[model samples]
Target: PADGRPIVELRGAGKSYGNVRALHGVDLQVFPSQVTCVLGDNGAGKSTLIKIISGLHQHSEGEFLVDGRPVRFTTPRQALDRGIATVYQDLATVPLMPVWRNFFLGSEMTRGPWPVRRLDIERMKKTADEELRAMGIILDDLEQPIGTLSGGQRQCVAIARAVYFGARVLILDEPTAALGVKQSGVVLKYIAAARDRGLGVIFITHNPHHAYMVGDHFSVLRLGTLELSAARSEIGLEELTNHMAGGAELAALKHELATVRGVDVEELPEEEDLTAPVPASSEGTS
Candidate 1:
């Protein structure tokens, strides 16, 4: 069942590096079993926001809350200890390792007499397989290197691993940025699966289309500041895309393009089809 309350919240959060400000008074809330999508262009402070939420960097200002209780973390481990897990674009998996090994990369299982501890490979493999299947991921070669799987498959494994490890909040950075249409669909499905299982999912991506597909809440960032934040019911896809592209900026761009190309701006293609695809380079990190 969905947890109706927010698991994490940031009020007036800010960060800086030397003289340059990376984030400015950003406020966000992540509810359990709901997908909160953060959309922004390059240099929009998206990375800085992720770092702050995932505990890689402390905000210089504002309140950080966990379950409405004020809290602060000096390190990523501290956040993870609170059941917050960050799955970055690279995903933090070793491609050459087997699926099971990657599933339990940092937290491997061990069982034996105290003096002769040994990895419980069989048990780990069985658990990994079952968990992946439960997430609707079907992989025939559990023993194969994780690199053999597609981008979406690797992401599913990473997400399933986080759930298996008892993560209550999962932060994903562009989980589907580097896949074909079909592959991106697969990743989106798994994201929904994770949300359905009651995890607060903070999904950071530049692609509004992907965000709209899985997000229940939307936050747009531009020039190191939050542009808009609202529930899904409050806005439609066109509004979301316009906001993400700098609503006014996009309008100007459209006019400029039409003028330069000698076409009627109003006669341009349907706004519905103008939604851009996820960038190829936006693929998750390994």
Candidate 2:
């Protein structure tokens, strides 16, 4: 990235619950105009890391820094106050609310003061429409219920809202997990749009293909540990997909399944060394 300073940085960041550690010594950097992708299968500490970064959970072990300041956050609002906005997978929206209403739900613009104040509906509608267009998204209408829009559109609306609210770092959790191939592409397009607008984006997903399409940095986790981390120039999509899928492990599993099917396991392809970027964490790192 052209920007030398990272908007968000994690130094040996880890989280633990009771005796079980969900993350261990994870180092990451999020720079403006770049998408830092965190790829991992289920239970790979992605959720735990997201919680810590979003202020839903504090790191039990290491450092979380925002804008060169070393600080701990106790709530999501604190993270938001620092210009780090998160768009969750379940979405923060009311199904029956109009697109504009959902766009400005918790942070609605108001007119007048005290008892005389009311929602500035028209201004919000105009702003929402404009912001979406600014991000290269054009909606037919803002009066339609948000639920009436496709999943891709709703996710795009949430992303547009985050960008409009002055978010400097955007953390998106599985934005394309529920969508089909086409809809996933739609979300990816907006993600690129956000990056082009100069926001540091943290995109969390298990799909390497989707991540590769727009990511500038990649990190893969497995069993709550950071298994791989590298710049886009240092890694390719196939290597990333292999890491997330456990390249050698998957091959071994295939061997076992082949035996049950009465097929010769010896014919299975041999696992090759996929090593390139070093693992971000190792045993007892934290």
Candidate 3:
């Protein structure tokens, strides 16, 4: 599966909202059994790029490809039809609904004829339990309200739902943003499971540690533009965290601060020495 072409690819993708350009010339590829992470602070065009790929919005420039064929999707259904599914931070589930009900909310199983048609509750419950277990998730009861589950559990439910529905590509938006250490670990485990199940995962997040945990490829975005892109072999945790934390721009600020304090900037303790070229910043003092 890894030897084949990417499930989806974006070539110089760009998006514009009238006079405002939210994204520009961005390239990304999602291959089966690999997690591709898009890391950035807020307003870094993560959402914009997601929209373009998930079919919520169209790319104004460049190409969006599925199975190496360029295409434009007019609606979310179009994207879903192409086996691309996006699971957002706030999962679209009825909080008060039972876990089994939520699992098959829109695509529920049915039985009997039109005169005596009825929901296949037994089959739904059994399938939901089995699916969750397959993803290494264990729920005490499927009858409980979904709202009673923890953030990570809820995220897992959404992921399982997506996987069960035949999604070849899964785009997760900040899946672990609101989770604690243990909760985040749970989510990351399922993400790895999804990757192992041969789904191309695009994990969008601001946390480098979380991204680095399950990511095979990484890309950083700054102020709606790409800062850096690299495969796992070409980068490390320290380097990934550095880019997420502003890289050289942050070094310049620390250098300026040390200079202001009359402390030798060279001894300020950084990956880069004082001689390294750091672009001067007027806002370093402020």
Candidate 4:
């Protein structure tokens, strides 16, 4: 955690289940005050990589390091103790629980002496509100069921909770996958806010637009191996999308599928063509 050292780094890290290889030769770097976006499609080994980083699974090959020191975590708690936290896509909140309750779910503060410990209701609620507000979140009531809040608000709550718990490195799994455009934008803003607060973030998502908006570095995965790695300045959003889609291979497959199916591969309409009428044959087909 000293100056110029990456907070988390994976060197040729890999995972396997018996003869089934889930990942291979993966290299990832996450530094303080930066967002490292991991882009991959379904079955591209993104899940496996996250598991290794979160200490849910150990790498079968190569090394996993934290703060430039090699470490092999046997459990997620060990990782958490070392200041690495993963916020999974599900958001991990009980729908019926109040927002403040969800925020302090497992790690609630206790009052009074030992053995007779009781939940410090007022303090926990006040701290939760303060933490959320610090992240630019404003809720009408912390006592409302977490399910009553929007998806973006819930995600922000989870993020603020992690940061408040002293997480030096935060790993987010597809944080924007289920939200609408406006809601997704809201979550993205907090992601940038988290980075601004000097936390190293590992953002895992298939959506390039969301990743590009906040990522300072990118690592693209394909079939359990790293295919590309670059800083934000070295790549464009279009190129990132192409890589995730397998670039020319995906294009070739699309053409081949179209040819084999005897369907014309029509070009997508331009932005200016929104008001134009579709051709009679193509109408209602697309």
TM-scores, all models, native as reference: 0.88, 0.91, 0.89, 0.90
Model 1 residue pairs with clashes? 89-284, 89-285, 90-285, 90-286, 91-285
Q: How far in Å is the alpha carbon of 81 misplaced in model 3?
A: 1.0
Ranking by TM-score: 2, 4, 3, 1
CA shift of 168, model 1, Å: 0.7
- Residue-level lDDT tens digits of model 3 in 3-87: 7788899889899999999999898889999999999999999999999999999999999999989999999999999999999
Q: lDDT tens digits, residues 128-229, model 2?
A: 999999998899989999999999999999999999999999999999999987788889989999999999999999988788888899999888888999
Model 4: worst 10 consecutive residues (lDDT sum): 277-286
* Residue 26, model 1, lDDT: 94
- For all candidates in order, the CA lDDT equals 0.86, 0.89, 0.88, 0.87
CA lDDT, candidate 3, residue 30: 92
For candidate 4, write residues 1-286 as lDDT tens digits. Answer: 3587899999999999999998999999899999999999899999999899898999999999998899999999999999999999998999999999999999999999999999999999999999999999999899999999999988999999999999999999999999998788888888988898999999999987778788899999988999999998898776777676664564565567676655655563322332322223221100
What is the RMSD, in Å, between candidate 2 and the native fold over all Cα?
6.2
Q: How good is model 4 by TM-score? A: 0.90
Tens-digit lDDT track of model 1 for 91-205: 7888899999999998889998998899999999999999999998889989999999988888889999999988999999988788888888888888899999999999999
**Candidate 1 ranges beyond 4 A from true positions:** 1-4, 250-286
